[model samples]
Target: MRDVSTLVSKTDELTYKVPVGLKRVPWIETLLLSSEPSIRSIEDTVKLEKAFHDASLFAVKEGYRRLAALNVPAVRPGDFLAETLRDDRTMAKVKAKLADEAARIKAVEDRKRVQAEKKFAKKGANKQQKKKFQQTPEDDDLKNLKTLEQRKDGGYSGKAPKSKAPKSKAPQSKGGRGPGGPKGGKGTKRSDGGKGGVRKSLFKKTSGGGKSSRGKASGRRFKAFFLA
Candidate 1:
């Protein structure tokens, strides 16, 4: 759940010198933006130029020591990004190269975020021509629901999914609409009976053209007296 940590001091440089920072440098990314002269594989040396572009990071003796043992060829800036993403070893390096967070919880959180970004980048590269997966409000709700389910399964006693929801995979009422509507569109209603319906109130309806009543209106026409 967290990065188990201890306090660090000047004497801890060898252990406390966390890995390199992963902030993207635009200038370094230029070579990667190109398709020509691409990096053929993950360990491409040419692409190391981008990593070492600042000299300070690349010049680190530790960096050279690690790079020298790698089997991949040199990569271009663009190629480096593309390859590092799919490589698990590189992903570990990525997490290692993060800034220090005073709290152990924050450091662990930062690691998770960087890992997710790398996963996203690798997925993107795998399908160069496919549409990007954009997050939406619906996805937010779905993620929340999944999280809740996991929490509950782990000996967690909390509110359950509303009892009104049928045990079956039957569709249930959605938005404000009736069972009769377009097959599927903005508000696709569902039903406990399996077939979905537009969500609507039962006891509320029209009473007639011009005339109206409170409890349950039977017949009516769309005109002036249609109070909101």
Candidate 2:
């Protein structure tokens, strides 16, 4: 088999002399023939692609260099007359496909942007709601403080009436006796069996005497009864 490097050198030598339309076919045929045996896997396909890329770069550089040496512009001017390989109808179809692809990509980007905005907006709204809820208690406390200050300064007149403390019942002994002792009976004995019993009897005796003289008379009777 012919060496790939030798074929490359020969193709390069012929590049300057060959017509533009015919210059590319020889190099393409040469690459295909050189790699035919090894082009069995994806890796070989990638290598072929790399070779084509390098060849294209080399062709572009050589073409520009040649044009520069000949005092010719490398890029065709807008007004320059030339025939294209594709007909106008084919070019129109290609342009339409390219425009459709561009529109599809832009639509995808716009959808993604709208979705992102909605997601972030929802998060922001949730944050604001949380902040409002968190501040509610503090706001109520401030209002209560302001009302209290207004009442203290006599600026507020709609104050609630003070609640009265409930009246407490007098404490009684466990035996159901009052502070004075047991209720009336004929010299009733007290549970303590102390001077409290005598004092209770004396109170009962004097309680019925409305006049001071009657009370004194009852007191003398009590003294005599006790002595007896």
- Which one wins on TM-score? 2
Candidate 2: which stretches are off by over 4 Å? 1-64, 67-82, 135-139, 147-228
Most accurate candidate by lDDT: 2
lDDT of 1: 0.48
In model 2, which residue pairs have backbone atoms overlapping below 3 Å?
none
Error of 1 at 84 (Å): 55
Off by over 4 Å in 1: 1-102, 129-228
- After the best TM-score superposition of candidate 2, give how far the Cα of residue 25 lies from its true spot, in angstroms: 18
lDDT of 1 by residue, 48-152 (tens): 534444444433443345445554244337666564424777656645543222357687889999999999999889676453455568988998888787776
Per-residue lDDT of candidate 2, residues 1-228 (tens digit) = 879999999998876454476735543233232222333455453355446557656666766665687676668568543464556786567567667767999999999999999999999999999988888777999998999889888899795569899998644434223345455323334566543344444444445556457767677657745642
Count of backbone clashes, every candidate in sequence: 18, 0
How high is the lDDT of residue 20 in model 1? 66
